[model samples]
Target: MPDCQHGLIADETETDDESIIGDEAHIVARSDDGPRGVSDLTPEDRDKYDNLVLLCRKHHKIVDDQPGFYTVEKLKEIKALHEAWVKESLHLDKEKEKDDLNYASYIDTIAKTFDFDSWDGWTSSLVSHGQPSIRYKKLKELQTIPNFIVSRFWPKRYEELEASIFNLKNVLNDLIKVFYKYADEGAIDKAKETDEDRTIRTRKFYKIDEWNPELYNKLSEKFDYHVSLVEDLALEMTRAANLVIEKIRKYISPKYREEEGKLLMTSGPHMDFSWKTFKVEYKTDEKKENHPYHGLKSFMTERAGRDLHYGEGVDTHYLPKRFEP
Candidate 1:
């Protein structure tokens, strides 16, 4: 198939020929009665790399049409021979190989900083009170990861990883900012009559102390809005982090196992909040007509246009949906 002069793209403007089309022809046909049909393999196993061979379109058709001649064993032997030949004949760039190894190491470092093993345990606090319980030391490490990402040069092949990293950084920064805005620090209260002073230090959302009903409602709504935003950002950050892990697994290490399932972090199956939806509903409510934050809707709408460049070089499809609008 490598010797076959089919599926090559001729570009008059460019000196080099484009990539050749190598169709993934199955050794054992996916379904019975097609090509080298077999009933023993599962649907998942049928599509596995071991059961597949890369061949030119013409050879793919020929092998499928004459399955008797190109049996599973025969195809596998041919594949093995071709691979051996490629290994011997093709000369890989040593510098590029070193770069790839370095890049893989860099990605591993980033993954470690994320601490995927303790992700669920720490992120569980997000939904409980819209604030993460990550230790200050871990928080500092997480904070520097964004800077680490932007300071390095990412390979073009792993653009998906790059985009996912940026999305995660954006969401993480937003969550941290929102947390700082509402997060109350530890405080101490001294009793007038008692000898001992009580130390009251709890991590909770700030509460408004206004007595006026209308003003209180307005402030309360604003506080609720921020809490919702924090939760939403936390969720987005989880998704983005998972996506980074996925891309790392795909492009760098096939054996890499981080999270058990597709989702690395989740706050359980509860009511999922969307800041965008909350903003829309808040704007439509007639009772909150004079809310000061109503004017901020226009600013939120411009997020996509303002931050679209973050996904530049990578497929924007990998970005979180929050950046869409």
Candidate 2:
């Protein structure tokens, strides 16, 4: 199967768009050692077993019609990449810090993508004639990122911010759903009814006055309501992200370790790409293998997502699930 984008599920309406994967033979092509082969082959043959890719109708047509665009090597590589991500062996290392710094990087990407710090701009986008066009762009950016959605990589150690994390995640999911729903239903409905031209009088089934004085007020009220739905959720995500990072800072030691990836963001009227970077650094804790994740029996335990530990034991210690130092 083709990989779904990280941190999200696909909108099911795509199915109705005639985007079905393999409804025809020509729509689904496979590669072999050479054209001479295929007199007979077993299911275990490496060519078929190891290289299968899924594509929608339009894409399959394009790939076949333009062989240069979808070379045999490229198609196989796509399948291989998707397969590699699915084989997650859970190679847990007891020696490492519990928080996945890489996962922190992923969260940081989300914070930046949503324009978390720029509320006024988001407000303008929300109420504009083209409402959601801005947010849709951001959503597409998030989806285009590869392999960033697997929650299993989350450091999974912080317990103090469990409630906050839960609330934030739940709200963000709500916002994403509403984001699409409004775009499809509200956008179309408004466009059809919103034009200023109003003149028609006939009664086959019925004819009605289009000069409704209440249309402006109705649309304005709905816009306000729509903006609030997203605004509240985005603010909550921003708050929860900061809270997770703050918790990590409280427990991080000043003594240094090895370097990890860094985050950089751009802003301002100049839009200088180097405007700012996520300065927080996570270093290796070689001096203390147990400096983090010290006592947890399993990284999968529940205490990581709660504020209280048993009366404190080998498995209970201060940690943040979203990120490490």
Candidate 3:
């Protein structure tokens, strides 16, 4: 977008009568029923219409979407020639760009195009009025209008205030940050509690309760209503700050340690060991000479000692299952 120039110009609704004519310029028809193409026009006419090169919507879209086909240099050249031709034909003086035309009306057109009505269901909207405060005032007025058909068009007006509200919000946030800094630096003192100003003074820490308390209180006494939104906000902020501090101290450290351990176990080597012992006892039911398997135990134990290398006096098992083999 081009930078806008200040001051009011002609209203957008006003139309100029000087027309571009053939031979020198031509209009490209957008559809089968629209204006004809440049090739059909004359080559020598002084008419300003000779300056227009009409393109169908598709071609225009292409030209805008991929400008390399008719590069920026060529586009600028064409625009300059066209504008010059129109200026000469209409005897119009070169004028600075108008802010009302460039910014406000353009914004209005976009808002109307989308048919967005009412702030009730919309998260975001755009406003295009000149003064930020006036736009906001209009938006607030919409809330008072009844929801019947008479006020059905309020959403469009409300949308036009959205940008204004955004701008104002930015201003407010900056002011709040300034006040907080002032409070932190001891540049501004916390207001003391009084019979009537008790809560109002306390809210200085949180809300836009008062920009100038003396003025605010005088107005409030006359109006007979609380204007201590700022003070209430300050109190809430103090509570929130305490909550955040407590949460950080109680939970943040141990949580970090647990996460660190999990990170190490998956990515590093660690050992797990177990310790237990198995004991075996041996017994004979019959005498060795009377039994067929008498020497089997002795033979097996001797073989086991030679092959397995058990410690001396370590009892040996012959029956595999019974002796804990």
Q: lDDT winner among the candidates?
A: 1
RMSD of each: 18.5, 25.3, 35.5
Computed on alpha carbons, the lDDT of every model, listed in order, comes to 0.58, 0.40, 0.29
Q: For candidate 1, lDDT tens digit of each residue in 3-66?
A: 6766534344466655545788899999888887866999899999999887777898999999
Candidate ranking (TM-score, best to worst): 1, 2, 3
Q: Indicate which candidate wins on TM-score.
A: 1
For candidate 3, the lDDT comes to: 0.29
Clashes of each: 0, 7, 23
lDDT string for model 2 (71-122, tens) is 6566666767765765643334332344545445655665565444653454
Candidate 1 error regions (>4 Å):
1-96, 130-133, 185-210, 266-325
**Candidate 3 lDDT, tens digit per residue, 1-325?**
1121322233344566443221122333333233332334344432344344444444555554554455534644666775687688565332212322333443343333222242212211111110011122322222232222132322232232333323223323322432232122231234322222211111233223558887766654422211122222222222222222222224223342232221000101113433212111112221111111222234333323221121122223212356665
